[model samples]
Target chain A: MKAVLGTMGDEVKVFGFWASPFSRRVELALRFKGVPYEYIEEDILGNKSPLLLHYNPVHKKIPVFLHNGKPIAESLVILEYIDDTWKSNPILPHDPYDRAMARFWANFIDDKCFPAFMKAVMGPENEREKAVEEAGDCLKTLESALNGKRFFGGDAIGMVDIAANFIGFWVRIIQEIAGVELLSADKLPALFKWTDEFVSCSVVKESLPPQDKISAAFKARIDQAQTNTRP
Target chain B: MKAVLGTMGDEVKVFGFWASPFSRRVELALRFKGVPYEYIEEDILGNKSPLLLHYNPVHKKIPVFLHNGKPIAESLVILEYIDDTWKSNPILPHDPYDRAMARFWANFIDDKCFPAFMKAVMGPENEREKAVEEAGDCLKTLESALNGKRFFGGDAIGMVDIAANFIGFWVRIIQEIAGVELLSADKLPALFKWTDEFVSCSVVKESLPPQDKISAAFKARIDQAQTNTRP
Candidate 1:
């Protein structure tokens, strides 16, 4: 069977949870690329629907992208698929080396900053400061990567920015509730500027979750963490 | 400047350490694609070379691929770059969905299996058994993803196979030194068979480190873990 390339008439659906950063990556990619799709919200915090299970038995996580009827899991993989399928507003750089660099930074965001951010905000009280320092180091490295450019991908936002939506939007809200200071203009001015530009973009501005809802959700998480860590 | 989409005359070089499975991924890819290049061995166990640091300052890890002076780091990113540059052998699947699946499982091996395998072999004494069980589960999930196919990418070894090189070759050696039993013909028959088939391929066979050297290398690692854990 011939592989169906991206057709405007393709049946594209996204299985995603409301507050997942990974799911938001997929959403931002679609919105950035001007693709049309139906959104199916999964209650991932509670029970994952049978449909999600059917589509993604291995990971059983959200942001499962379906083109026609086939499912693609993993946010990075789905982002690449979306780019491959729809070539108009490119999610990646045209140059192979540039594409490789974009991928490297995107994975860096996932592997380094996200973990450090989680640790800084929710780790044991004794280790919180060290985790904050480590998280700052990761952000500083990332800031260097930004390198005076308007975005990680240069003038326009690309996959790296999409991968970093949490850093741009979610962290600001979560940091206040968690009493952690990781991302801000004083420490990482370039990244802070990029976040401002990224979230301000209409495509991102309209889709980012409501500030109050995210605050409520993450507040519950911090409360849970504190309860769990009680001496 | 026009992007160089892989010219046969392009200067290619691979900076890698001998025992690293990630570095080996890049080696297998170049050999499988029949791309010729210079190999620079780095003494990663001791001190890293200035050149490696110069090329990849961010991660400062090996398996830095240089194509006409531009460096690409991160094993998976380098794999994609190689595939993108050279059109002949096609490192990734042509079909977009199939490509997505390949990327998904490749990352699964890295993200899920690698750490679990490390813990199984090198973790503290009491945690070893549970780590082994968790490692087995990861392998079992990977086995299911194999899905009766001769290779993870249908009949041929692809990125997933390359990514699982540690599982295929390194784990078999490391497990013996560490005195653990995880991957085997009885437990995961398909993956066992795939490993046999994978290593037998001339390209993989020739590039894979000699068993004696790997055994010696991993023995030192296991010994180091024992020393560190001896409180």
Candidate 2:
């Protein structure tokens, strides 16, 4: 899809937040490709560094990857770039049609799954039930995409699976903190299995943060949501 | 990015809506690559054909590009697939970083511009102003992407330019039909200029619909929206 030759001299820097699935997506690609990169954690919630702003002036968002000081914004864009530059451990399928399918589903996950799943857990009380139903429908569709493959990329973590990191890892913690469960073995067995398979992957394991850290961050989020919702 | 060898025997079928930017994107890429294909105009706003349903079972949407019976859905996905399969008239840049930027801006057009711009034109009266502000902001950012280039692709119509077909052509008609002025020479000179440059290209001119036809279609849409908005 997109990479460069990974070496000590390669000027690879990742501007990311500790908890953003977007930033972790960049790290996952680099690690999967065995690319060494200097990681800079951003104060995403408070103040982004001037450098981060400079790199991604338009979006000014995290998961901005820099190669030789040139910035690549958007995590999926960065993923493809890494895949192309490194040439090894290809994230996208070689076949063009399959690659298109991968990109489509990856987009569906980001554009559909994230919002619905997040709302199912974190949205207003009045809307949570509807979001849960919507999120379940999305999970059903996603489970079908597995089609008995071990991963969306088939037998390994690929672009679609990486693009779905939020549902795999963060949702597990966030849903627990919010006392909601939209994704489960009973409802979406394939996706449920994928969650474990993805997070347990030796390569993905390194990119994931401690579960407790995620729990604490989301716990604070829940408290803030409750405070904001209070009359 | 992607392509195929085009000839009489190649079974390249495009299931598209005549006025849909998404479907038109697929057509634009094919025309750019000199690929020969059958174009089936779908009744997208009505009952979608069984073939369209069968081709893209997941999204059940238009711009389904079928190559020798293999289906590729999503306009952007199909666009890249066309670029890869054709091999001639490359739609994407060869450089990995440039390719990534192209992908980013393409997604930005579909994900950000379309929704914001559409809402500005078609949403409820109360929401139109906010959407106008939002759509304006979005256009400002897009104008920056031009960055003095004749097109987002530079010198010729490329992925970004083709991807922006909606804003380049449809908006000129839609905004006028909706009695709104979101994009204009005075407001966004670069994007304003890009619209003409993109649509006037011989390759794109073949794909665009007649202005009267677009006017008639959207005139009906505005009437429907008004009826729905009435007490």
Q: In model 1, what is the error at residue A89, expressed in angstroms?
A: 1.0
> Could you give the DockQ of candidate 2?
0.85
Native-referenced TM-scores of chain A, all candidate models: 0.95, 0.95
**Candidate 2 C-alpha lDDT tens digits along A100-213:** 889989989887888888777667878878988888888899999899999999987889988998988988788778887777899889899999999889998878999999
lDDT of 1 by residue, A1-231 (tens): 122345457788999988888999998888887788899999998899999999998788998999889999999999999988887788899988889999999999899899988988888777778988988899899999999999898989899999989988998898899988888899889999988998899999999888999999999998898677767
Q: Which parts of model 1 have CA positions greater than 4 angstroms off?
A: A1-7, B1-7
Structural similarity to truth (TM-score) of each candidate:
0.95, 0.95
What tens digits encode model 1's per-residue C-alpha lDDT throughout B115-209? 88898888887887888888989999989999999888788888889988998899888888888878889989999999899888889999998
Q: After superposition, how far is residue A170 of candidate 1 from its true place, in Å?
A: 1.0
Candidate 2 C-alpha lDDT tens digits along B59-94: 899989999899988888888888777888888999
Residue B30, candidate 2: Cα error in Å is 0.6
User: Which one is best on lDDT?
Assistant: 1
Interface RMSD of candidate number 1: 0.8
Model 1, docking class: high
